[model samples]
Target chain A: MNLMMLLEMAADGFGDRVALGPSDGGLTYRDLYDSAGAASVRFRADGGSHVAMADLSSAALPVSLFGAAWAGLPFVPLNYRLTDDELAALASRISPAIIIVDPDSPDRLTGIDGIGLLSRRSLMDLVDGADPPEPEWDMTGEGTAIELFTSGTTGEPKAAVLRHRHLVSYVLGSVEFMGAHEDEAALVSVPPYHVAGIAAILSNVYAGRRVVQLPTFDAHDWVTLVRAESVTSAMVVPTMLTRIVEVLDAEGPDGPGLQTLRSLSYGGGRMPSPTIQRALELLPTTAFVNAYGLTETSSTVALLGPDEHREAMASADPVVRARLGSAGRPLPTIQVTIRDDIGDEVAVGQPGEIWVRGEQVSGEYRGSAPRLTADGWFPTHDGGWMDADGFLHVTGRIDDVIVKGGQNVSPGEIEEVLVCHPAVADAAAIGLPDRQWGERIIAAVVLHPGASASSDELRDAVRDRLRSNRTPDHVEFVGSLPYNDTGKLLRRVLRSDLAHLGDGSTG
Target chain B: MPSLKPGSRFTSSVCTTQVIVVKGAGEVDLRCGGAPMLAAGAAADGGLPAEGASGGTLMGKRYVDQDETVEVLCTKPGDGSLGIGDALLDLKEAKPLPASD
Candidate 1:
């Protein structure tokens, strides 16, 4: 059940194929295998409790990941964007660890106590010169394989533990072995700390797809890499897609100049329907996929396939067209159920907490007991519901749901209506404290370039689409909204930013 | 007859084929090259396969028994074909879902 099993199979099945970087010059499956063996030896000799990387995505990521697995150590990838104090704090938590630092930024984490820092180049040199360790690896699935710190947009980050079995089940269930064509390449821009980033490396390697790494995400750089490397596929967050769509649209209405890209998957946050619509129209040749999952879930537990995307877009039925915003159906290997406040399963089309049960779902965090129930369902505090046809729609977090006059109002619904307006490019609806109602809705709208819309008009638009009660009590025009690096809208930030608008007396 | 479970490795006695059981329960006659497959790393009891048993297996292919109850993923390919009891297993079609990662 070790992650090495996957690499071993890849090395044996397609040892000569290039597994990462440019197809012409990248680490082959054999090269990665040997490097991992070398790394395992180094990790064992260093006697480190864990393998941690505070650097950006690079060739060293995969090597360190597999090496840590072969040596039976947890691989921890810390967010490199954190401040020095925050980064040091996280580093201290995983003390007595081997940390891989970006070679260019040698002084990034100077004087971090109780850690062994190795430059990327130095590690690569050691791997090249060292003897390969034995191929044997512990097969027990109980050992921790990865420790990913959840992106704490709301509060302090928690370390999520992923065991070997959880990860193995995810890969074996979702991905077909050597399913990709020899020429296929997957472009990965997400940071190493993200779950999608780790999943991308494992899935692409097993599928025999070459991986092209992008250290930092710039829409222009992403477009250029796709063109330059002949990248056939990519995974991006909603914000990254919006920017990429903008970049492509600025190229003129002719086409998105991404002929090589066959499939594009977006997740990590709620996608604005307008942006995705424009992208579908612009990249006619590419297949669009909307994947939904969390850090606890190995990766994607539910997905909207390409055909579904086109079908929903073309269908005239309002129900079918609306599914374009849905997260599609759950994966064949996963089960998704909606439950109400008291843990009772809700009726069809009822909004409630999203409870999932799957082998890949490890709802366990470090230092805390697993959140799974006695029977095994993990209550993902995310608010969502399933449609009549079984399509799942995720409405932001449950904690963010506004209780307005004893009615549950999802900010996403109101935000959706506001963004649909031609003048509105982006929007966020938050429930501000109100004396009349428990919470009053406030809309923060970002207009499209050179576009304008009055607060009354925006409220009327919401009233037209939904009930008047759902309309925002107040509307504030803004140039931009706050978002974490991973693209999750910082609703908490918005709550504070607009606190002055409502003080139990106002609104 | 070894009990089969997901992730349990098995080796063919008559050929180079090796497999990991993806599904199955209790004791079952999982065979390769018409000979019972051994738990991974077990010593082979007999020599090469009988003339008709050497049908061949492909790397990265999945083999399933009748009624679709038994499934095994071939981690290594060999000359011997996969089987259960007296029936030869069929190559499972590669149903690839969209790459979501």
Candidate 2:
């Protein structure tokens, strides 16, 4: 079924229960369904398949999305943060009909050829005016629900098709694995235009939970929402979490605060342990999650639960904890395997490329080549391994692996090791050019508040905690690590930054 | 905290704000209709909240995270009693994090 089915079912039982987390005003299920009905009527008569929206996390986006779904059309949510050039490129590629925008974001779209433009304010008025006819339907297969375009860090962004069935499977896995309850309130800070944010939105909605969302993520507003709403759950990234912890550290444990909060799901990138630990200390009652997956995978392939943190810390084996750095075990319905470079299955403990085949995983991209192997597994492009206990650990991007002096070092591995340090708030390791070792290990790190140490002290600290090979050869302090819109670390950016230095730039 | 000077423009009410480097009174005021927006206008008139404003300070509840506190501009009139558009904070200073295991 389409997103329409969800509204239909929700309306019968959960109507007026607050279909979406609050924004502009409380949009009831009746409002949502009726608006979708309006959008559907408009879509069929107008024949607009490509509906592009500029707002990231507004109720307008979702309403239009459901509107498209009811009409059995494809929904493309444009990244409001993208530059005009990027939006222009996407416009050339998709050529959408309805471009819903708002006061917060209005790009140069008035002159664009052959397109219908509606600001969020006017669009709502239109949806209200259109009297919906009977649900005369001609929707497509559940093959692709949202035609998500990749962030295009490595190259140009391409549409990654996510099917409706795939999304339903994903929702099931999240609700089951997360153990979220109905009364639980979720606060979403990540932009809904991204998968992590969408996951946060849909997962909470699917569970029929209350949600409190911030228009955007600001470390300040996030903590305040948690207190005012007593928001028990949230989904955010490491950088934001670090700042929240900093605020909490300066403030006491009991202030304008949360009461019913239970979790803060961390995704969009690997959770730096230092950041997670600091968050644990700050919002102690909130369970922390390290969720891992790609856009093609419908959001979550595996998750490192809060209960496993102790195990991660207690494990003396670097390889074991490195595995702990993994994205997580496949969800209940998923199967994860390690494949050799040639796509052959590797032994359980060996570090091979990670592959996944399951319901939640996409079979193929409509406009692109298939990402699966001959045997039906999706090549995650992530270097990781499946353990004896079936947990999945992610090392780094296979393409991101650095070859230095005949040693294979994934930046994720190096960063994971360094991030465990108490003083280190966040870290990124890269293979820098070296006359001696061809490419030497170099790390750029950020320190936690009220804590500071020299680069040499940090090097020694890692040496004390890890093997000589794994220890960073050089250390330098950085203000912050660069990140894409989705919160994924731009390792290549770090590599380039590291390249722009003298041999003695190591601090 | 020391670096933050007053005069940051606020849209809706915020819970806390730090590093508000507007350097003038004209920071973008976050609003939902008349109040601040929670998500994309979710909580509206309910984004951060009216309580975040205090003494017209922008760094208090309106711009901060939960349980955490900050100083803000009082939304009240300086002449005497609390006035219209006066900033009100949920609390004056930082709050502790949730106690952990």
Candidate 3:
């Protein structure tokens, strides 16, 4: 069942159970359900086939989402961060019958014609005006739970259709995987527009637990809420984790928030070992889980649970290193396999493209197929190997591998070494054009505050540590390296901006 | 502050007396002809176009001017009545607070 169905199945009185609230406050499930029902009815009256909500975080997004579900119309939560032109372009693409904007956005979207706009409060008021009967939407049984868009390879974002069945499956499987219970509440810090954010919200919602959402994440607010809400679980990206660790370390043991959290999750971007090391120190009892998946595969396809993490740490064997640096082992539901370019399964320890298939998988993206084979294994566009133990170890994106100077170089490998350096705060490795090496490796690094390291030192530090051709030929030390909001390093940005090579111009 | 861009920067404190709507998608002519520097919340470095500013109260707070074009469309179509205040204010900054370590 989708989250909406679970909400419907949950005792109506349970709506009184906190459905969602900001980190500082809350809303009853009943109130949420009623508001959604009303929004659904109003949506139908508005002649809206689907409703577009541009909220950052509010009781409104959930109300609209569930309300759209109750009404049998696809509820699209447009990213509120996009430029008007981008939003207009997306609206043109989605062609939603109606549009709802956060009161802070422009009343009418430029470029897009005829789409009506409504403020969130006004939408709620419109619901208040209506008689919010428990909505009885015609059951389609085969519709998607949510439609989220991710940056597409075509240079624009494409919507990924996550079916209700897939979402429900993710919820049930993820809860079991994470050892989450109904009594637990999770703190959601990422942008709701991303799959991780949506997963964090829905998993808690369907399980009927409090989802303490921070409208936007702040290091201070995250700790304060965890302390205040007694939040046992948290989902964070690497960048956010670094900040949380810093504040907690500064606050020391008396820092009330650190002790309360039990299980912490890291995903959407590879968690640097240094960051992970610090995280382990900060939340000693909390099982630092590495959740792995993509937008096409719903939320999580693999999970490296805390127990396995312990095993990886305890083992002195290099063979177990995959578990530590792993994206994760496949979850209970999905079937994962590594296949060579010719579509044949590779033996353990051979790198190949990752493919996944399951009920939790979306067969098509938007209306098209981004990954499909004549025989039907969804290509994950990631290069990795599955060991004899069936654990999957992801290296990086298939295209991210850099073959430079007759030697294969994975930027991720260089990044691994750079992040290990004490002075380096964050690092991203990209390839630069070169006369000698064909494709030269260049590293962009962000130094720790009050720390200073020259390109020569950073480069030599990497060389002395790993005697591979992977040492960066050049180093660009800027105030910061460019990264996507999800905390994944944007090597493309670095690759394009590295024309300066050594001169210190930021823009 | 690794996320901040060099050109456009937002203060941690609030900007503007009324609710602010930063309409930046339109091509702008700057000293440099690339992306305007975003205020630092998520994508201050302009690494990702969708790195939206974090919304919540900044400093004191910015009110939702229900009648404003951006506000009306943002909230609900045709419901010129209520506004979201103090929530997501820091996120609504005119420019992204660029990452500056």
Find the candidate with the highest DockQ and give its number.
1
Off by over 4 Å in 3: A1-3, A22-25, A106-111, A128-131, A138-140, A152-154, A176-183, A374-376, A464-467, A500-507, B1-101
Kindly list the per-residue Cα lDDT of model 2 for residues A298-365, writing each as its tens digit.
77777777666546756888655654466656666678888888989998878989888886788566
DockQ for model 1 equals: 0.58
lDDT score for candidate 2 against the true structure: 0.63
Where does model 1 exceed 4 Å of error? Answer: A504-507, B1-6, B22-29, B42-46, B50-54, B64-71, B87-94
Model 3: per-residue Cα lDDT over B40-85, one tens digit each: 2433232221123332222211222323222110110111111222
**lDDT (tens digit, per residue) of candidate 1 on A238-345:** 999999999998999775489999999999988999999999998898999999998898889999999999999999999899889988999887999999999999
How many clashes (backbone N, Cα, C below 3 Å) per candidate?
Answer: 0, 57, 36
For model 3, residues A1-507, the per-residue Cα lDDT tens digits are 335654553333255566676433466666676777888777777775567766677767777778777777776777777777787887887664677777876554744654667788788777653556754654333576677877553488877887665775565444421123445677887776778877766666655667777888789999998887888788888889888888888887776546667778878777788777767766768877788888878777887778677677668887886478786678766889999878898888888889998766775677786465665468888888888787888878878787677666777778888888889888888776666666777888889999888898888888887766878888878788877666776666666678656333331
**Chain A TM-score values, per prediction:** 0.98, 0.89, 0.91
Better of 1 and 3 by DockQ: 1
TM-score of 2: 0.76
* C-alpha lDDT of residue A186 in model 3: 78
- TM-scores, each model vs. reference: 0.95, 0.76, 0.77
TM-score between predicted and true chain B, model 1: 0.89
- What is the C-alpha local distance difference test score of each model? 0.90, 0.63, 0.64
- State the DockQ of every prediction: 0.58, 0.01, 0.01
